[model samples]
Target: MADLEAKPPLSPSSTLEKQFEDFRHHLEESESLRERIRAVAREIESVTRLIYSCLLLVHQSRPIPEVLEKVKAQISKLKELFHRLAGILRECPGQYYRYHGDWRSETQTVVSLLGFMHWLETGNLLMHTQVEERLGLKTSEFGLDIEDYLIGICFMSNELPRYVVNQVTAGDYDCPRKVLKFLTDLHAAFRMLNLRNDLLRKKFDGMKYDLRRVEEVYYDVKIRGLTANGDSTRDLGIQGQS
Candidate 1:
């Protein structure tokens, strides 16, 4: 009996139990955070769809100003959602990438829409910093991924082909030439970057098709002798607004 008593009872190890308890609490907190992030991301995605629907009106030959007016409200909503995302990410202080995948698709979509909108509003490539500013995402903590920005730009490029086609159909003959010029310059600019991402590279390759489509449309317009003779600054481009 003394031997058993001296050996002590077979109680659980307080140290091990405390460590496991800490781990469980950590996992619970992490799950809660992820759920919050996902909620904000879902809202972001919803707003993106709303903005995209408004942008489609442009393809339907709707007036640019009218489409923009509808999009403006959604932009305000996206800013709020992104702000909420940034706030939630601050909970961990230094783990932005840990949860980045949660909103990756939504953010990419947002950037694409914003890039297209910026092009319509200003006729310039939407810079990364500009996107950050537009979304109110400029925090010292963490922010938009560069790959997401590049991918979004590629997505924006995909829209130009369709826009140019519709523009010519709408009797805006010079639209093709201006789009061709813009795409040429944009493609040249992309060539300067040493992009290593497979997805981004694939998307960039697709821009060539966009450029080709625009080129074909421009040549068709040129052959038909229907090109506009204005100073080339009245459509799709906001002078001095970039």
Candidate 2:
């Protein structure tokens, strides 16, 4: 009893317990953040596709007022999402937000894209100028004329691969692999959207040509078989077939 009493009671280390609790909290917060990131990433991808669809629709002379409206709405949502993400990030230690890491760069890229999209829709060149001022993007950086915003998509696609590969190899963070996948999916979405836009433009051009040819054929047949009263009566079978 004396020996036992001489020794102090054994208890878990409060420091270790607190450390473990902090670690668990960090893990939970990280997981929640990753989920939010994925949700926003998916939203960004879908909005990108919708924007591309609007571009193609407007290019094809389709009534795209609704699409344009939706693009604007989605862009607004993206801005809100960014704000939320930034808010969460601010809770983190200052290193991440201060460093020129992939997350920071990617967020800025989204801002530039949104700005340019507004410029395209509203014909407000000021939007593009402001984007350049805010993001330090240049017209030559995208390899396109001043009137074109699709060039920004190209710039984004070109830069994504390297950043994704780096994230995959760095292995310092959780969900690096998921981040890579999201970036890749974004690049793919942009490419597909661009291709679809080109195809739709071609299809519209072809349809216009076909309509013109049909009108030409109708006029030629009418001129060849017209009466004085501007009516055709010679070809009952052919006219009926047409």
Candidate 3:
């Protein structure tokens, strides 16, 4: 009977205060997650830059074996960073796409660099599955985005024309034929996808120019009889622009 004193039916004001507190807690948690994602993204960007620098050594005309050796450390670092990214994402399960933009550009760069390296070593395009395996992304939750992979392949294509030009200038006339074939195949493969993404479409468009440039170089070498089997094979060793 003493306890029957009404507890004021839980005042409306008190109910509102409880609701406000819940909202504040959720807001704080959301901010915390955003901050954490940003921090991880920055770290990923840094490691990606290092990986890019290693890939740049390829442009220096260093032997592929040596370039691969130098990049091995950076590639390992990148894998670790990706693992860290995956860990952070696990904290918010089922929201991989939600935070994907945070690291989208860097992931594309990584894919481009890795794809280029793989091509150098094996004379083939790096498959998406191989990229996932290299990055230790064994789960669907954090697997490489297909669009990013395709875009990265486009970026890799951009590198080849320059590489071919450089190799030709360095007296490697055979380089253009090899690079032209690669770019031609890559461009055709990219055309197979029905890309709705504007950025991807733009990048693919640029690939056409790259293919044309490489083709021009290949024709120059071919028509001038500068190939290894041609009359100017000896003169082909002279360094000059394509």
Candidate 4:
């Protein structure tokens, strides 16, 4: 009772200083996370570039088997890098879309490359599920974005015209007809999407040109009677003359 000393309450200035310190700490942590993400992104870019280079052999008209064999190693490396990216994203939880821009373009390119490769081998569009599976991504936090998948498919469509042209130039005239049918279906499917995304809309617009170019190529091959059976081309010619 003789020693009635009371503890002083925290001053407003001190409280403010404490809050500022916390703010600073948070900013530092966010910056640190950004730096780490950038580092991982650089590694992902390197792996992606390697994978792209391997895939480019297709444009060289290299045998598909040989191209696939060479691309397999890069694909393994890409999957590892993607897993590492997913792990990093896990640390921040709920912030995936924030950093998604960092990797979105590269991911689109990877998807396009893989989609082209799969189409070459299977004559089918690689589904988004298959892409996630190939990349070893979990559907929960690291699923491939639907926009990225669609954009990638558009990019793959752009490749088909060039590929058909190359194949025709290489005397594989059957390629144009097959590619034309595939692109026609793909274009129609894309038209069904209610796309509001400007970039994707632009890409889909380009797909029409791609379809047209392939159709032109198919017609070129048909008019020349270069189809594998020549029967359809001859029939078309007969109809045209009549």
Question: What are the lDDT figures for the candidates, one per model?
Answer: 0.86, 0.44, 0.82, 0.82
Q: Model 2: what TM-score?
A: 0.37
Best by TM-score: 4
Per-residue lDDT of candidate 4, residues 52-150 (tens digit): 777777776889899888877788877988898888888899998988888888888888888998999988889999999999998898999999999
Candidate 3 lDDT by residue in tens digits, 8-40: 566899999999999999889877887787787
Residue pairs with backbone overlap in model 4: none
Tens digits of lDDT, candidate 2, 128-241: 465544433333322112323333433433322333233334432222222233333333334344444563334334433333343343344346443124333232112221
Q: What's the ranking of the predictions by TM-score, best on top?
A: 4, 1, 3, 2
The list of candidate 3 runs beyond 4 A from truth reads: 1-20, 228-242
Per-model TM against the reference: 0.86, 0.37, 0.85, 0.87
Q: Which stretches of candidate 1 lie over 4 Å from their true place?
A: 1-21, 228-242
Cα deviation at 95, candidate 2, in Å, is 5.0
Higher-lDDT candidate of 1 and 2: 1
- Report the C-alpha lDDT of model 1 over 1-242, residue by residue, as the tens digit: 77866955445797688889999999999999999999999888888888998899999999998999989988889999998988888878889989999999899999999999989888889999999999888757667899999899999999999999999999998788777778877887788999898999999999988988887888788778797654333442423221
- Tell me the spans in candidate 4 whose CA falls farther than 4 Å from its real position: 1-15, 228-242
Worst 10 residues of 4 by lDDT: 233-242
Off by over 4 Å in 2: 1-25, 61-70, 95-242
Which residue pairs show collisions in model 1?
Answer: none
